[model samples]
Target: MKRAITELFNRLRFKHKLFLSYLIVIIIPIIVLGVYAYKQSEQMLKIQGIGGIEKNVDTISGGINGSIERYNHSVQTIVYNKTFQKIVTNDYRDLVNLSYDLKEYLSPYFTMMTNLDKEIDEIKFYTQTYVPEYGESVQLASRVSEEQWYKEALKGTGSQWFSDNGIIVVSKFPQFSNDKDTNIVYMRINEASLFNNVAALAKDDTVIITDKQGRIIYSNQQASAAADKPVLNTAQLSALKEGVIDFGGAKSYLVKKPVALTDWTIYCIVPAAQLTQNAGSIINATLIIIALCILIVLIIIWIFSKTMLRRVLSLNSLMKRVEIGDLSMRVRSESKDEIGELTNRFGSMLIRLNEVIDELFRNKIVQKEAEFKALQWQMNPHFLYNTLSFINWKALRSDAHDISHVVTTLSKFYRTGLNRGDNIIPVQDELEHVRCYIEIIQTMRENSFDVVYDIDEAVFGYKTINFILQPLAENAIIHGINRKESGRGVLRITAELSGGKVVFTVEDNGNGMPPEAAKTLLESQSSGYGLKNVKERLQLKFGSDYSIVVESEVDQGTRMKIAIPA
Candidate 1:
């Protein structure tokens, strides 16, 4: 029994186990939500009623915004015509003529505005006086020299619009191309019709625009005397003005939007229960779905869990075999389920793991051989040469001096190459090696060429791949100077610390190689001793990100600089 439980535990995926757990946890409770066990019908009726109200109000709010947008477009067209622009653009003489002709040009606007009176109680555009005592109805043109909107438009600022009373209004000032643009035309809006349109258009609720005092400036539904009566008092408007709210008694839901550049809020109110009637139905249906889903899951899990458990347990045993060093083991599955997918992934992982183990052993043996080869290749001729030099010195003291020159050349070559077994030696040490090689060559072949070393002291501390600089200098000496037309050739070597890097250059005043030859020499094949080996070694150690720039002209000198990362 314990073995079977262990097998089952290993066989099941985490997600399937979680699903089985969820079925046990939620199956009973979800079945209960679907029951709707409440006996009271009144609460149910209220829920259904309020839900209907929300749907109605949502529809009304959508339409009212559309209607308002349409009216705004019409008002914009009437006030910003060409005639308005022409009159406003005129000189002082034209201004006097405009004052007379403006009323005729503006007559169409007034005519359309009067038609709104049929839908709304009243519409007026007025300028306010500091003292209402002077006259209750003070005309806008009388008190202010210019309206605020006209002032803006006069400077070619563009059109202006506002909503007041129950109407939407717009204004446009005239433009004078010769000087500045001004608003000479002021078209009044009738806002009362805005509320009338809202009330008429909104099937489920009322639309009203009011001041802080809660006076109804516009009602969209009715032009009757009752339209003038404010539905909400100052107190109720105060609540609406504060913001949108939910009234629990009415099961109401309210949404409000405030107009930009204004204090007024556009509020849409509806009963909450009505908005979610469909969602409530969906919620109830979801309870049923959940119960059904759980029961089906349980039945399916019971039927298939044991069969699945068998195959996975089989795979588990195979994996254990592999874990215990049986790399030949593999799991086989035919079904396309979560367990099957996982087994497939596991099989691939096992194959790769075995391959990696085999490759690792192979690499170990190869690395051992490489280390042996490198060891055999390292040579130190220094000891033999030094012993020979001591013998030569003793013979010279004994009056046999011919052997001294041979001993000296061999010693120089040996000591320079060996360098006391130090791999990363100083550049100065490298220069000494080059000097010894030159001396050896001079003695052997009677080679005579000028070699000058101009090295800076700052770069000695840094470690480098040894023999890099020496070969460059050697190549220059043997190939460049030896082949030159000039009888006396010059080999100039210079190095310095430049911008935190060691800049070592060896330039010989020999006949510089042609473009193709110089390129081939610098990037010589692996079989040859040239710049290619240096470049590859530097790249393998550092990366391609570091720069090796080579600049040369045929007759001119070659400049190669290695730029290392800071």
Candidate 2:
């Protein structure tokens, strides 16, 4: 058996074996892929088919609904107008008599509705007679004398309605009783006019009109000679349910939405075959190409098997260049289409990826500057503590006990103000710091200034950025209070919390600055100098939402409001 097999193989020509091998490699996968694509294309077709129908339905429905509302407004105007009612009750006038001149009086209004509302086929007018004998000159449709709409109008009910058989209509009931007996009149709107407003989408192949029932009253068909197809059946209609289902032999898709002005359902249908028909053409072309590709693949496999070591070496060199941030690297190719676009996009992505890596490395330096900035804060407070501690200890050794008490209180102030390296301090600690500062100020000059703190204890524990309150306190002292009457410069500080923010106001009973000066001080472009510096730093640390606002009147003292996030 082995001898026979070897002889059979030797008898086959090299070119024949090559072609057969290539066909096995290329043609088999093509057939497999084609089958898969065919299934997917069918599913997509159903969805697109259903979508086209649904979009047309929505367009028509919205347009029709809008036209009904507009027509109702026009008819309502005619319903109450005395002259229009006269045209109905007395005698129907010629088109020209209903106007101001010898020309048609209601020329614009009636013509726009009747002649322009092309979707509507007719607009009916009715008087007191239900027998339909009185209005024969108007050329009435085979008398709707006993129709429900006529009966309803006689009973004084105005009909703004959507009717069966795909009709949308609105009417006005005028019960006019002047000198004699009472008589009712109805101004009927042409159903087609409302439909005409939406005529653009009405003629599409997938048009549908659903009544109050969840069923189709009208569907699309053309003026072909063939007899009309029966619309839909029970088994096919079952696919219109809310979940996915196998449609007819060719898959179908469905969607449901409520019909306008009524409790009706609109079901959209899509056929799967329409979506994926192109895939069949693709499959045939792919089969022919695969037959050619099979010969090429066999030749390549044999050549590569002989020179595997050399090709492997070239691949190693290329990979090494790619590893060390060489993003422009790409394997050369001659073919065109999707594969080429994909390789081009991948090369572009690598270039962008390299740029992002470089950017991240540079941001680390900005992060370092922020760290150095935080360190600067530590040194200033540490200097204040050392100086205050020496003064307090030296005063204790001497007999000046009041001085010692002052220094001790000042030391305690810094301790609470700093609070073991915490960046945020409570409002209570801030208030105590202000009280101690006031004491130190008093020691300098007796009764030279008066300070008051009107702080709410309930709000003391609310959090604020450290030192935020003290700077504003100092601003009022330097710029507001110190410029007052010689004997007593009054400074008042109040702190409260409302709506999840610490709200502080510092006001002084001193001679306020002129409007221009104060405004310039607040409005200057350069910030972070004295009061400006504190405001800028506060904003940078906490953002614009948590910052200070200033308000003042020239003689009425100055008030500053601090809004800091809690």
RMSD of candidate 1 to true structure, Å: 20.3
Instruction: Please report the TM-score between candidate 1 and the true structure.
Output: 0.34
- Cα TM-score per model: 0.34, 0.35
lDDT of 1 at 51: 46
After superposition, the stretches of candidate 2 with alpha carbons farther than 4 Å from their true spots are 1-387, 520-529
lDDT of 1 by residue, 504-536 (tens): 777877667777876776576645445665565
Q: Pick the candidate with the highest lDDT.
A: 2
Assess each prediction's global lDDT (C-alpha) against the native: 0.54, 0.58
- List where candidate 1 sits over 4 angstroms from the true fold: 1-383, 391-413, 420-428, 439-448, 496-503, 522-550, 560-566
Worst 10 residues of 1 by lDDT: 129-138
Candidate 2 lDDT by residue in tens digits, 52-107: 65676677666756765665666677667676555545443443453332124333
How far in Å is the alpha carbon of 328 misplaced in model 2? 33
